[model samples]
Target: MPQQELFNNIYQTHYDKVHRLCKGYFNGHEGMAADATQEIFLKVWQHLDGFRGEAKLSTWLYRIAVNTCLLQLRKPATTKEIKTEQLPDVVAEEYNPVTDERLKKMYGCIQQLDETGKMIILMVLEGVEYSAIAEVVGSTEETLRVRIHRIKKQLSTCVQL
Candidate 1:
């Protein structure tokens, strides 16, 4: 397939999830996520021709997204400063596992965690599997399970009060 078509396919397939992933990383800072998402796709477009088929496409896209988010976090203002000019005109919305009702509080609580804990729980919130999260975060599956359990309890308590 041509590079443009391949990129278009990948973007269409991954955009919503990728955008959500970036949004989560930015603590619901939609503008920052929007910028990072664009940068991620640009990188994907530039590099798609060399994809080796060794990893799942989603995995590859996520790797790019996580890296992009991490890079964005390293910048001066941080995700907190890059707020959206306006909120979405939501008539109403329900929070699912992915869109946790407590997401803002959760993210705030997550900010208080150590880097490793934050990574673990962030992946869990994103609904990434324990095994994949372990691979990405460089921990054992058992270790992640323990960490996630603790993290969830901690966030729940924090959110409740």
Candidate 2:
């Protein structure tokens, strides 16, 4: 396949998920997420020639997107919290109220997590399989299972508090 076709396939497949992930990392900064998403695609375009397929393509794209967002985060100017309500109102009629509320609460709790904890939970929340999460996080499935259990218990208690 041509590089453009490959890039288009990846972009179409992962854009929404990657955008949400970027939004989480940016704490709902739509502008930042948009910028990061573009940069991620750029990186993917540049690096596509060298992709040897050692890992799943989604994993590789996520690795790039995460790193890109983190790098943007390293800049002091990018650290301010943008109010989600103040964001440009796009077509959100499709957003389910209950799911949005849950996601907001979940992200609120997630903000308290340390980086590694946040990454693990984000992958899990994104519906990445436990086994795939283990690969992304570099731990055994057994260890991940225990950690996820503890994390959920902690969230349950914290939410109730």
Candidate 3:
């Protein structure tokens, strides 16, 4: 396949997942997530030629997305919070004030986690497989399982408080 077509196919296939990943990193700031998603694809375009198929394309793309988000978060200028009332249609449709409050607290707790923990939990929430998540996170599946258990326990305790 031509390089452009390949890139387009990959982008189309992975854009929503990458966007969601960014959304998690940004605490649901849609604009920043979208910006990071664009930056991720730009890096993908630049690096696609060098990809040697050693890992699944999605995994490679996710690694780039994670790194991009981490880099963006490290910048001092990106630290401010932006509030927006927009919620996903599903969330809005099913909204209860109590549920919304709980969800907000959960997200806040998630944000307080260490960077690696945040990434792992986000990927888990996204329904990425344990093996795939381990690969992306550079951990053994056994280790990830243990870490995820601890992370979940921590979140549960934090949310309940």
Best by TM-score: 3
Predict model 3's lDDT versus the native. Answer: 0.89
Best by lDDT: 3
Q: What C-alpha lDDT do the candidate models reach, one value each?
A: 0.77, 0.79, 0.89
Q: Write the residue-wise lDDT of candidate 1 on 67-106 in tens digits.
A: 8888888889733544355454243466354454566677
Residue-wise C-alpha lDDT for candidate 2, range 1-161, written one tens digit per residue: 99999899999988988888888787666788899999999999999999999988887887787778778878878355654555333658676777766766766787677666777777777787787778777889999999998888877876666
Ranking by TM-score: 3, 2, 1
lDDT of 3 at 35: 92
Worst 10 residues of 2 by lDDT: 80-89
Better of 1 and 2 by lDDT: 2
Q: Model 2 shows how many backbone clashes?
A: 0
Ranking of candidates on lDDT, top first = 3, 2, 1
TM per candidate: 0.76, 0.82, 0.88
Count of backbone collisions in candidate 3? 0
